[model samples]
Target: MALAKLKEAIGKEGFFLELDLADLKSVKQAAEEFLVTWEKLGEFTSYTCQWCHDSPLDQFTVQGYDLQFGTNTLGRYYFTMLLLPALQRTTGTNMTGKKARVINGSSIGHIDAPIEIPWNVLKAGSEDSKLKG
Candidate 1:
């Protein structure tokens, strides 16, 4: 719907991109497509996200990461790191006269009650853990 609205406003000048940041495969695909197009155009870009995904309010996982934390912070961090090379190349001031900007659109939720990481839970590990083997 957001994509549709943006397309309606921008018409042929707009392209739609869908990325499910919860999944690494999707992130890789987005990074590859972005690099190919941006490098071709010799244009620079910035990225932003308002971390909004959430789990049911009452539940907690043993591994200890909240759904919003995974979606907002971890996913944003991974995507930025993955695309840094392309972003840097395109936005380098020597070429485009612009430095790449990364806007992590955070909210009062994170600011007001930041998670006190349970390093123990983080280390305990779970099969569903998105981090890695």
Candidate 2:
């Protein structure tokens, strides 16, 4: 499988995490697992998060937000904030001879979204509003 190839490619240098961003519970569990696993590694150095949610809207999150916004925006924000302490720990220890870094990826199409977010629709999980790239 692709995961086996990735494990072979990284060898002993890194590991992969499996998480579902649309589900808050999954995100939280993944973060907890990462913390536990990395703590056993004895040091942390850097973290990279690459999340992209751009598909036809077909579901709503448990929190009543559109799937794309919930997963790509809110969920990613929550996950990153949760990991800050672990990232800070790495800097405190000078583990990699540098400060811990975080890299976030965004799509250029984001600029096309309306300046005023449809908060009401998002909060109410209303499908009346269509999302455009």
Q: Candidate 1: global Cα-lDDT?
A: 0.55
Model 1 per-residue lDDT tens digits across residues 67-121: 4545565656777787788657666554647666665555556554546853333
Weakest 10 consecutive residues of candidate 1 by summed lDDT: 55-64
**What CA RMSD would you report for each candidate?**
6.5, 4.6
| Candidate 2 weakest lDDT stretch, 10 residues | 42-51
Off by over 4 Å in 1: 1-12, 40-66, 92-96, 120-133
For each candidate, give its TM-score against the true structure: 0.60, 0.72
- lDDT for model 2, on a 0 to 1 scale? 0.66
Residues 1-133 of candidate 2: C-alpha lDDT, one tens digit per residue: 7767877887644457877776788889988998887742223333323324354554667776777678778778778877877878777456456667677776665666668966765654455545555
Number of the predicted model whose TM-score against the real structure is largest? 2
